[model samples]
Target chain A: MTAELPLQDASLVQWKPNRDRAKLIQMIVKVISGGFAAVSILTTIGIIGTLIIETAAFFSEVPIWNFLTDAKWTPLFSTQQFGIFVLISATVMIAFLSILVALPLGLLSAICLSEYASPKIRQILKPILEVLAGVPTVVYGFFALLTVTPVLQFIIEQLQIILPFIPDLKIFNALSAALVMGIMITPMVASLSEDAIYAVPQRLRDGAYALGATKRETVTAVVLPASLSGIVASIILAISRAVGETMIVSLAAGANPVLGFNPFNSVMTMTAFIANTVKGEAPHGTTAYFTLYAVGTTLFLMTLALNIFSFWFVRRFREKYD
Target chain B: MDVNEPTGGLEQSPEFVQDLEGRYRLDAIFEFATWAATAIAIGVLAWLLISVLIDGLGTLDWQFITSFPSRKAERAGILPALQGTILLMVVVATFSFPLGVGAAIYLEEFATDNWFTRVVEILIGNLAGVPSIIYGLLGLTVFLRLFSDITQGPTILSGGLTLTLLILPVVIVATRESLRAVPDSTRLAGFALGANRWQVVWSHVLPAAMPGVMTGMILALSRAIGDTATLLVTGAAAFIPFSPDGFLSRYTALPIQIYNWASRPQAEFHNLAASGIIVLMAVLLIMNTTAVVLRNKFQQRS
Candidate 1:
């Protein structure tokens, strides 16, 4: 609170440093502590450096245009196409599906836990939902491939009879991966939105009720609008999560890299592309090996953009009720 | 506003009252939707837990736990993966806990709220959101490449260091929260007794905050254990038939191994993957339960 001072305090203070010796020791302590804090900055630098150098090398060999415009990504084949979107389009499709499920379920659940539930009920349930988040993405991947895909296949088969136009469903389809990805991200959405929901002042609700608003009307008209920015931030962050999610998509979403609109068709995501491509040893400095860094850079940029926006929203727009 | 004379003044007709009923019914529907939403989230968790158990419990045996990984599904074990995971956790916990706690202490207690500190804080926040796979790339190029002789390229050490980085931001955030929970009066009291800032923080604040810090540490390790994309990208050996010998040795963790098995076309491998998940979940459960208990203790104390 007193940090506004230009110099050290001249006024009488209750506890003052005894001498220069004490001041020296304090300075040393501060430097060491600050040094530790600077490690994160060092980490950021290292990450950027690694991504840039390798991505540069990859881009030098494969022009930037092909990385964007080329529809086919066959880095391993004799006839190669360096189109990155072969992976991105599929990634976007799966992420889209995940957000579709996550938004409604996550937001409503957050509202439910924050608004509708009694304190006792909320205390019991919130932790359980958190545990859902704690379940590993790898385990979710296993669930998607082993359990969800088969179920989707069965349902698709039944649907195909009526809508014979339905394409043959692949076992490693994007739909199953997207579904479980939605579930995996649900806690992120629910917990974040719950915080935003909880932060909406009780007085707002009380005021609405005094104005003869029903429970639904009070929540929708007062609490929801008040916490709109926080809720939006939660969703954008959740999208950031879904976009970067790897194991679930890699395991369930097939490695085919088809640039198609069909969710039932097997397609590879950028993460999946990076993951599945590495099982076979590509010689060092080869284009195939360098592709990893290229994809890594793309994935990093996408997430970084989303995260920066999310953080901006959270910091700038959140209403301070107090 | 004479309420008894409502028919003459403010009384609602049957039509107005019916409109009110419509809103009340909608409110009731809204409540039920919220309840149903909560139930659906819970229901998914229940189904996930039960299905894994029903499928996995049969294969989770002593041999499965003790023996090394094998080509045959029946003989395959998690010994190498378990050892690697433990080793990785050891590296992460040992190295990161101090760094993270120190960073937190620095941010909370020592540093002035300057532009540099603000930048550091913002960087940490962004780092937390960066995808795990990018960290793997960083490890590959930085630790594994720059310090090639040290890490010996894509071994347990590289993976461990990568994980250390991955969990650092989280550990910092957790430690800061715990430190903040230590009331200011404690610091004032320590200084009143002629304790220096470092002394007060080291002697009083840290000890008071240790349980919450430990809880955060365990949760961080659990998170590191579940990670796969990073390990895979860092070249975790998918088929290490023998146990890893040291930090420099090629190794696999539980998640990587599970992913390896799950990706295989054979039906039996899927079952084996399920069994591996059971083990991973068991460990996670213990760690999380401990964390929860410690957190509750910390909450009670404060």
Candidate 2:
């Protein structure tokens, strides 16, 4: 055993010192990189913890029942009422209207790009769509408030003469914001849906063509159904984005938190409420201040649910043609 | 070409001819509708750009670029906001790029198949989908309040840190994708050369993935530059008459300045807002173009 130990020591002595140094450096790199990876996990914890702690503080002052069931939201005023539904209704309306605009346009654009457009045309159109996607939401806010709102008001005025039932469009109405937000999200929907459509195998298309199906019929029937999960996932993601959208709504959708369904009315969305209120000097620990976190918790939960469902739906229902 | 003709030796019924014509008509209509949808989408973008350019070009003189925000519309400029935005980009890039790239390298190159690694990957994906505003809430609580002693309230440092967290997931994902694209043959070759794992990654793998890493970094920075909500929630000042002198100094960004100006009731301020948008869009265009160019160059080389 002693002779074997000496032989092992002799082998160890032959090992270069630089190799140990290299190994030490590698270990340090691994530790550093691992720490960096942990930051994201820590950040998630930070976001959830921050929301919970502040939301708990908010609920301590105002009963959860008042927050949920109240008809009014006037936390900024002396006569404070906390009606979460008032903000949620407006948020949902805008998101719904925005989706109404985005779905048809986005899906059609995806169909055009994926199934119809030549490769050259696809190359040209894709970047144009990307440019649309890349525009800042704050810029969309500017466009909505300044340009789209005026045009919408003019159209509403002309429509009033014929229909007579249309309400007067407020200068700051939900329709204008919804329309612009729809435009903002259209590119995302188009791109994601295009990916889904493109993933539908060529054999499927060939099979449909062999069976005498026209391009439109095949797309509507076969391709769309085959890629339904991905398309739905994209739509859900867009909805989540619209729900979380802040700048456009805050700038265009007015600051009145009313519980109603009229798209023509000036309304406040959840994100807009948080944004506008934070702009004011609501000192820390105040009920008004805590309201931001409470509202944020609601927004976070909503988007989280949507995001989770989107990914889940994609995994659950993804059609494996292979 | 006549629908009534039995060209293929099969008898053509009148109903069949009519149905074929109807299908062709429907196909043409659907085609036109798709084109129209694409047109409308592009048209909105064109209109936005044209209107902003028409209103902003006259205001985007050298004087406007150099001067600071003022109460008077005639003399007001975006110098402070522009500087703050540039500075904030620097801070965000410096911090997020290294951390994101490192995390990506760990996950892609070093991590073994384990529950912790799986959880980290999943968490990163979900974090990317979280709203920018929630990150703002996080910044308000953690950086502005919890770390107030270090951050000195809502300064550029706090805002930059908030944005860093917001975009880290994007960067990590992008970097991981690029690293994954680097063929395993490269690593194998390095290993065959008796190089250690870190040496192989540092010398060979990382250089190959640098182009994509840079593209992702630029895109993340562009997102950070245009982000107003997070900064607003982090208490970025509306009227910073002076430029941000340091990381801890109070600051305002281009988007925040634009929001402030656009929200006003005055037409002159709206014009100023358009000019700010012009500047902001210009910056974004340059970054995006550079990213595209880099990606194309790398793709061609490979």
- DockQ values per model: 0.69, 0.80
Clashing pairs in 2: none
| CA-lDDT, candidates in order | 0.89, 0.94
lDDT of 2 at A140: 98
Give the per-residue lDDT digits (tens) of candidate 2, residues B1-302: 78776674434534444378889899999999999999999999999999889888888889999998999999999999999998899889989989999999999999999987999999998998898999999999999989999999999899999999999998999999999989999999999978899999999999999999999889888888888999999999999888788999999999999999999999999999999999999999999999999999889867
Q: Whose DockQ is greatest here?
A: 2
Model 1 misplaced regions, further than 4 Å: A1-26, B1-18
Q: What does candidate 1's lDDT look like per residue over A1-322, in tens digits? A: 5466534555645455675787687788788778888999999999998889889999999999988999898988998898888888998999999999888889999999999888999999999998999999999998988888888888879999999988877888999999999988888999999999998889999999997889899989999899988899989998999989999999999899888768988999989988887767565699997899899899999999999999888788878876
lDDT of 1 by residue, B26-101 (tens): 9999889888878888898888888888888888999999988888999989999999998888888888988899
What TM-score do all the candidates reach, one by one? 0.94, 0.95
RMSD of 1: 5.5
